[model samples]
Target: MAKRRALISVSDKTGIVDFARELAGLGVEIISTGGTASLLEREGIPVIGISDVTGFPEILDGRVKTLHPAVHSGLLAIRDNEEHRRTMEELGLGYIDFVIVNLYPFQQTIAKPDVGYEEAVENIDIGGPTMLRSAAKNHAFVTVVVDAADYAGVLQEIKEGGDTTLETRKRLAAKVFRHTAAYDALIGDYLSQQAGEQLPERFTVTYEKIQDLRYGENPHQRAAFYRKPLAGKGDLTTAEQLHGKELSYNNINDANAALAIVKEFDEPAVVAVKHMNPCGVGIGTTVAEAYRKAYESDPTSIFGGIVAANRTVDAETAGMLSELFLEIVLAPDFTPEALGILTRKKNIRLLKLGDWSRAAERKPEWLVTSVAGGMLVQESDVLSVEASELKVVTDRQPTEEELKQLLFGWKVVKHVKSNAIVLAKDNMTIGVGAGQMNRVGAARIAVEQAGDKARGAVLASDAFFPMGDTVELAAKAGITAIIQPGGSIRDEESIAAANANGIAMVFTGVRHFKH
Candidate 1:
């Protein structure tokens, strides 16, 4: 019988030597290339150089080595066909029983700090993916292994039956296709970004598994966490857990909501969120003061909520936070005393996000939502309007303090669900109404929540008011000033209502509609 031949080439050499040595002990001829061949030879395993079988030296810096027909025909030829046997004999070709390969580290290379375009392009593997696909296409005749994790099973099967079963070959072949497709997708995504194509015809994304969760939002649903390959700095995926139990699906969602709200503030801010909505938001000179204001904003709802602070958590803030029954606490940094205090809570999850500057430096990203049969992709909502950009539409202009409070309310209301209304005063949210069906109902809800506190506070609406009823409700609630996107057909009605009530109103023109 002719000797069984196996080709081994890999960038990740984990368990390669042991696998190769075992194959050699099983009387399988080993064929290798470049560094793999050198390592195999050094480990005392006999190897047939790829160039030796191709009958040509590796040219073009080793890129042209495995493209020759000699290597491919060996893997592609049928073992049982008489015509294939004749062709193989005539061409002096032999059957390659195994093709083991792993592609170059293009992902890793591009992840470097200052990876040049030439360096990134050089790392893209041509010969490896080609060989993997060829072997996989003829998987019925040839065995292919792209992952080192499969080495043990293949070697065991070979030791038992002298060859891998068809079933195993087919499974490994499917894995090969998935691996190569993902690799190609990564390359295409990188090149597309380099070309500055924002919305390409084909949108492809890749994510690496972080963990298999115990369950999804519900206990019955299975779920897992995946991180983007090139996630921006200060992203939640880059957060380090300092203390507490593993994060749950709900915990992550609420924490992300809190983080987004806190990012809207450059000052020391604290946001307490429940069920993906900010129950309370506060900005102050110090984080501790912010925490106090946030807690006072909605003390009942802030219980067992996710708390995120834009500034470092000092001992003073930690002391106050420890008094509450919160789920998670996230911040850019935490003092040693603060960590010690917060770590005392056994079930509370603490996440530390380093390098807060990256949040400001990050470019806009795509926000994708999965629908029944398709996905909705759009640019993220990064539009922000300054106080100076607002145009007073009412007869009364907002005072300096009212303008500051109105801007603060606008930032918080933008993150709230529409139809949304936020009542804020002194840089703190006193009431919030979100996800209502009508703008008037939302305003009423906020007014009801604020009660006496709504008097003299500024109101922010997520979108335009279709009618004057919303303005009338705000006026009745004693809301002194209001800010909203003014594009409704009945804009004059709302303006007249605001003027009649002596309430200051401003039009930002840019609507923030978050659903």
Candidate 2:
């Protein structure tokens, strides 16, 4: 077997010294760069600096160090190619069998509230990713290690087998590419955000495998779990759960939508979500009343749905909730009797999201999706619109009672699928239209559900109207005022429709489309 040569250069020297020492013990040569070499020298382990082997000093503000052909040609040159061997021999470039690197903390730097734009820009690494891609590209001959957490496992495998197996090498290389991809995305996003560009028109993200789920959306499909950014942040992932079944894909999605809506209310609130859309919502004097009103709002759609509540669940509320067939129920807390009552449903998911109002934890966790041959990532939909943030835009201002219902309608609308319409009054949703193919169809469903009560109720929309039809429907249904994101090209038509009917309208400057 050929002797293994590992090149280790990391901005984060978390476990570099120990890792280098372990490589030395395994008879592997350690080649590193800049601080890594200095650190290993201090640790009394022999580490060759890139300059020593490449015979070129690190110049151009340390940017010219690893960019040399000496490093990359060594990493990329095919080991089995006779012509490649001749070229390497002529230039005297050694093959790199392993590459260990981690990029600068650009994500962490930008996340700091006080960090300046210049500081965030400088934290973007150049040479680290170059070496990582080179090693990762030649996975057949090289093992790329970007995570310090993988160091111990790599060392164990090398010590046992005298070298990393090809399977391990490929897996490690896949991780290296993922690491560098995520690093570049964070930098790209930071620069674009700082420049106030139009969200870069497109966003890309890469994530690491954080876990493997029991199964994907279904047991038939294999699945794994990954985490995006927020490595050191105490996000919702860190929250405590009281009990329930292992969350399924649909359960998590609908639970998040339910939680977002429920958190919008300061008073006791209950929201039920089905197919990632809010099917029922209610706010009341007590948690029990809230749940009961929410269930009554659309009991037909609430079956097998995920439920979220703003207030701690009491025994009375739990008893009422347990009577139904819910997939999940989440609240800030559960009274002893409530937990006892709820735990009887072994397959139900229960979550505890305490005191989100305080934001005592870090920034919210993000949700990411994978598309064909690519992926998409975005911050969790956690923006809470306080009553103070609302802008009453109509000539006829909403009454204090109407404003309260407007906010409640706003929360429920945010959790519904796009083209949504919610008719709500008296702190309970009277009717909701979710996932309709067209906005007018959604309005019809909402009005139909509200029936005669539609007259005097408030309405909210996930997106603005393309025309005046939805506004006319809401006005005909007796909606007091309508709330929407309000950036439509036909804004005047919708506004005129609302004004013509003597209905009030407000602009929230935010759109909530669950789909």
Candidate 3:
């Protein structure tokens, strides 16, 4: 039998020297490219360069080296077919038994803040992907590896036997295609941004799996957490888990919701979320007071919920947080005393994140939703109404105190599911009704939850009131003012209802339907 041959070319040189040395010791002839060959020879491993194997010098600034038929036919030819073997013999091509290749760091290069188009374009790998595809196409006879993490396993498999199993080869081939697809997607996304195409003709994104969760929303379902490849510096997805058991799928979802709401406030703020809806939110002079007010908002509903705070958690706040049966607590930082207090809860997950300002500034380019057979894509809803942007449409104007509460309620309602109603007072959420079937039902739920606290509070709706009933209900609950998008045809009726009930109303002209 002819001696086995393996081709290795990679931009990431991790584990390459050791892998090449092991392959050489196993009697597999190593074929490599410029940097890879140099690194192997430096480590005392014999390597045949691409120029030596193909009998051609690398031209076009090293781009034309691996495009030769001698290299490709070795990777692509069928080993089991007599005609293919005869053609390889006629062409003086040797069989490639294994391929280890990784593409250029296009994603890493483009992620730099100062990268330009020319620099990014030059980093795109052409010959690397072509060789990977060719080798993967003949996985029946060739073992292809892309990830450095798999190097040890491939070496062990080769040492255990003369070749890798067909199952392992197929798995590695699949990984190669996935890796290449992600690489191309990053390039496409970067070029689209450069062209100022906010919505491209074809939308593509790539994510790396963070972990496989214990279960999904339900115990019977399976789930894994994945993060976008280009996610910015500080966000919930980038948060570091500091203590406790692994986060479940539901914990991450609820924690993300809480974090999003907490980021809306510039002051010390706390938000508690359950079932992907805000159950409590508060802003105060101090984080400890904020936690107290947020906890008092709806203490029953916040049980076992995720809590996110915009400020560093202190010992006082941690003591309060530990008293509850919370699932997770997230903050920008935690004092030593706070960490000591919270770590007593063995099952509660704690995450330390970056600055809230950075998290709030990030605006995703697209919002993607998957349905049964297809996906729905749209631009992300990133608009927020400033105080100056609010139009007072009622005879009575909101007081300065009412306006602050109205803005707070507006921010909270945007994160709630559709048919959402939030009643807030003194920058604290008194009541929130989320995911109701009707606007009036949601208003009623919030009013009932608030009880006497609903009196003198302000109401914010996610969308325009389709009817005047929600307005009338809020008025009866002692809601002093209302903020809504105000686009419904029955806007006049709602305005009339607010006027007759002596309630002030403002039009934001922007709807935030979270669902």
Q: Relative to the true structure, how large is the alpha-carbon lDDT of every model?
A: 0.92, 0.82, 0.91
Q: Estimate the overall C-alpha local distance difference test score of candidate 2.
A: 0.82
lDDT of 3 by residue, 402-492 (tens): 9999999999999999999999997789999999899999999999999999999999999999999999999889999999999999999
Choose the strongest candidate by TM-score.
3
The deviation in Å at residue 278 for candidate 3 is 0.6
Candidate closest to the true structure, highest lDDT: 1
Worst 10-residue stretch by lDDT in candidate 3? 356-365
Give the per-residue lDDT of model 1 (tens digit) for 167-236: 9999999999989988998999889989998789988877777888889999999988888877766778
What's the C-alpha lDDT at position 330 in model 2?
85
Question: Candidate 1, TM-score vs. the true structure?
Answer: 0.93
Q: How does residue 52 of candidate 1 score in lDDT?
A: 88
Per-model TM-score, in order, reads: 0.93, 0.75, 0.97
Instruction: Write one digit per residue (lDDT tens) for candidate 2, span 1-515.
Output: 55678898888889888888988887788998888888889889988889987899999778678888889998999889899999988987788888889887888788797999778777878898999999989988888899998998888888888778899888898888777777787777667767876445676655566556788778897777555564442223544667876766666667766776776677888998888777788888998999888998888999999888888899999999899899888887888999999999888877876656436222454466779997676776767677788776667887888888888888788777777899888899989898888999999998998899888999999888889999988887788888888988999899889889998888898988767
